[model samples]
Target: MRHQDERPEAPWAATNRPPMGWNSWDSYGTTVTEAEVLANARFLAGHDEGVLAAAGWDTVVVDIQWYEPTARPGGYNDDAPVLFDDHGFLQPVPARFPSSAGGRGFAPLASAVHDLGLRFGLHLMRGIARRAVEADLPVPGTPYRTGEIADTSSTCPWNSDCYGLRHDHPGAQAWLDAMVDHVVGWGVDFLKVDDMLAPYHRDAVEALSLAVRRAEQRHGRRVVVSLSPGTELSLAHLEHLREHADLWRVSDDLWDRWPDVEAQLGRMARWAPHSGPAGWADADMLPLGRIGVRAERGEPRHSLLTTDERRALLSLWCLARSPLFVGGDLPTSDAATVADLAHPGLLEVAHRSGGGRELLREGPTGAETAVWGAATPDGATRWVGVFSTAAEARRVRVPAAAAGLPGAPDVVVDVWSGERVPLASAGPATGGDTVLDVEVPAHGVRLLRLGTRAHSGTPGPEEHTWQG
Candidate 1:
């Protein structure tokens, strides 16, 4: 294990905030087509003044199985031949992505997305394609053959499409370099590398990171690398993670159920301390609006969570400062769903705030409530999130002192409602001992922005409300 101070400096220093985007996985899964991807990209890149574009949701990521010719919902053909170039580099399946037919690859689609003023990304599994190894193809810019670099003994536990590369093999780094160069030419802005971090493939991650850095230097492009499906990672590996990728998952796939959302409270808390400007602990994609429309996990349907649950989910993710990857079919999303994603207050907390930390978590079994807090960019205001995990409505309270906001706050704005919530004394306390009490609906949240007396003025009638 490397000490915090002994770790190498991070390769990519341009990621100032967590990424905000829409992914094709939760909604379209392995069977997502080029037409579907373009539709979502159009939805995200709506008129320059559209809600999504205005909220800085400018990335459109095409998830896994894009190279498979016969991919479908809930099924993967492990025996299907993997597609690759003569140099052992993977390419899009022309049958599925027609634009890539004349060996143009994703360049045409990437240009289309770029024309819409949106960034394009792709999902990739770690290691070399199994078929490439079997074919004994040459690795571009390297003297060794693909078979020489392949580590036949190591493979993904769940997917058989690829074989792990041997870190000791002389051609491993060259192979990665070739792969990165290919994507760089295609204008990929982000690369969500899966099956690497979850199983702690340190050598592969390091090789890939270095390859990305080298490719960026060679092509003069910045491609954000994100690790996915991080089921479990030790605190000792925090330095390594930050040194390699821009974003790494903190939990496994988080679905649309309340339980999945509730489980993230603890995961986020545990990983919060490790999150910073260089790297973030992803809580997985947001499963809201219409989802699983041909997904591998379940049948197509609208999100199962209630409106309040959706709000809580966004509140928690924003307060935790996790990367926001909207996972629904954007084109089919309702107006209300779009409004939720476009909320300025939530976006502020997610992209501009800092020093986020868990404050309180307490309640009886099956009815717990949790509190998370973060400092606004200017540090004059505090963004707080109070979540009710119960099935029944609950009154959640937090003393100003507990929230690190000393003295009486002149105004407390409910982020979602844009209404001012009145503060009252918790008990026999006086002055600065005031506590805020608000009724949070079951599976709901109260996202508040605290304005201190010194920095705030009296609120108008329309802005003031007492829910206690």
Candidate 2:
């Protein structure tokens, strides 16, 4: 079915840009504490003209295992007692988050983040907690026990903390509704639900969507519903995802590696048609700066990706309009990393452009160079990206027609360097179309802003040139 036929209107019209934020997974893993979260929040909202603040990064997300009292850096104790209320709704571990004591939940932390001019978010698993089911806790507003609504046969493949909900049971919806109510009360602005999308669990996704909608109606709050670990979903499921989630992961946990980054080019192309103001195709978190400080996957160190590779990653993500979640330890990041994250041109394309599309993909089967284009929000200019996916440096040419520019653009500025690149030919071409040629290093990218003519009284090409 068509997107419009599946949904009457954009369910998440409130969200216009892809959500940008700092998530705790790559930096602190499952052991991130309240102090660490606050430190990052402080840096994000710091008055020192930080990169995060300058780049409009406004969300602070606490990733998985926040409720597990015995959670450690590299592992999780699934059998350990989790912090939850009598109604089976999870809460932060007070030992790690003292503010959540006295049955206050995350309201205190969320309020602090709000005070800093940012939104707060949390990570959650798919269904009822195993502990709640074992205890047979009563479903809120209903007499049915947790076991009645829990689907014992359905469990997350990677985590042992929860069982999927039985959609056939009325109590399942009630349980989900109560969970949303509690989180909404905690002032959550976003929720990343994991283990629900990778396998394309339609029943659970629909149930959670209904529960979130009901909670929004009841409390008048907007929470961006994000589904996680999108490694297996197909194009056939696009409508279902758009109808349910504000953002959904388009790839697995993307890390700091060239192959993983290279693989996303095609994934983004396939998912691009489904992305828009209402729903985004998330190209997971950017693992730059100080990652794996306390991670499960690898030892603590700076990202292995070269500076050029990092730029390519960011450029492609912007061209695709994917959600930007920085997975670095912000307080410890170096000055260069911060400056890279604050590139104004890339941020503008990411947040202010529309109609992103891949214009070209050519070369051998595995060693292709790709070009992508998107128009500025006002349609006055076009942003173009040329990426080299080969093992060696390659020269790429993007024709003006392919880039969606009217005629041959009189002005073309490198987005990163701000240097005006002289067109190969001055006026319209006689025999062939005008093309912009760029030499991109292996796994590197070149971004350009094209316009028919320079803005009136705008600085001359040399004036805006970046020395670096």
Candidate 3:
């Protein structure tokens, strides 16, 4: 039951929005079973009220362990799992994916997903087969030692049991080619390959990029390959990733914590201009709703994010224009959580506008955190988001001209609360500036959609002045 995408290359280069989907690792961890994945898929796409089709969680991914059981008991690392078989081929663990064990690959699961109008995806490491090499296994068709071909000296410092690929070696290219053939043949829509960029192996990253492109030509399917866990990729590297992958991670894994979200959003704004219709800087997965894992120390066994935190979650995800990979239990998430995460206005900002920069004012630790704004296609409208992490509620002001208006006279409507708040008075005395004052709750935000006005001003006093 090997799946093959026998179509043209147009699917990969679509002129529409990028792919959207759900990943299992963020929610289920090592305890996830085949039935749970299928059930989640059903909830997402099967029924009339299916969240997947209704809300657009179109990619159903099985992260990490597909070949063997993940770590057991006391502190497990489900993020990194071993995935290979005795015969030197990759297979899904019998207990989790029964069909994949007998050379059938993931066709059964993928077909089920396609039947539900969703795409199938899986995670993989960058190098040649490691588990098989560790067992001194032989390559499928060639007469070569897996260890001899593997660059044993090169290993991911954080992960054991695998060696980095000797990119220059013939076996390395051959191994990658074969692996791509296997996955694409099995109907993989999205492939998140680890260590291709995080450790920043230039050679492997380049080779894999080429390998995936060749596979796309061979299979004639529009497969999206994504590079994972990398940060601050160079223009050259980003171009290379774009040549191969539809999206690339601009940071390491993002948790539900606010600090991580802030750091990611701050860094991603610098890469705003690079994002386009297809290529994107992924700021990692979104940990909203009720995540099942005990992510933080001494916190709840489930999600610890509050309502404000969830809004912040959506804000950062939208502001960064990253892939919206939800890390929450789909079946049990509350309506508010769903509404906040799946807000159409927010998604339009994330996908259509490509996000904007943050204008800092005053931060919590005396450091200022302010605006996250973006210009849309209409050119007259702009999305302005003000965030305050200050000790107390602070008045956040947005200048009309700075918000992409011709003059300081502008009116903005709050997207969240649906309130139209007027801008402050404008005149030569105050430098002809229109200011919109919003009282942002401590560590909270106010998002606005600003539009230009004909001519309206409130006179300012002689001593009045506008702050830069």
* Each prediction's TM-score versus the true structure: 0.92, 0.91, 0.85
Please write out the lDDT profile of model 1 over residues 144-186, one tens digit for every residue. Answer: 8999999989888777888999889879888888888898789
Per-model tally of clashing residue pairs? 0, 0, 4
Q: How big is the positional error of residue 338 in model 2, measured in Å on the Cα after superposition?
A: 1.5
Worst 10 residues of 3 by lDDT: 459-468
Q: Give the per-residue lDDT digits (tens) of candidate 2, residues 1-468.
A: 123333323323443457888999999888888988888898888836665764668889999988988887777666667777888888899888999999999999999999988889999999988898988888878989997989989988878888899999999989998898889789988899999877889988888888877777677767788998898668788778877888899888988999999999999988875787757899899999899998867889889898889999998888898988898898898767767777776776776567888888888855788888987555667788888888788777667776677677768888878888765553454247777878888889888888764432222444321111
Judge candidate 2 against the unseen true structure and give its global Cα lDDT, from 0 to 1.
Answer: 0.81
Candidate 1 Cα outliers beyond 4 Å, as residue runs: 1-16, 429-432, 452-468
Please rank every candidate by TM-score, starting with the best: 1, 2, 3
Whole-model lDDT values for every prediction = 0.80, 0.81, 0.64
Taking all chains together, the TM-score of candidate 2 against the true structure is 0.91
Candidate 1: 10-residue stretch with minimal lDDT: 459-468
User: lDDT tens digits, residues 79-111, model 3?
Assistant: 345667544556677677776666677888898
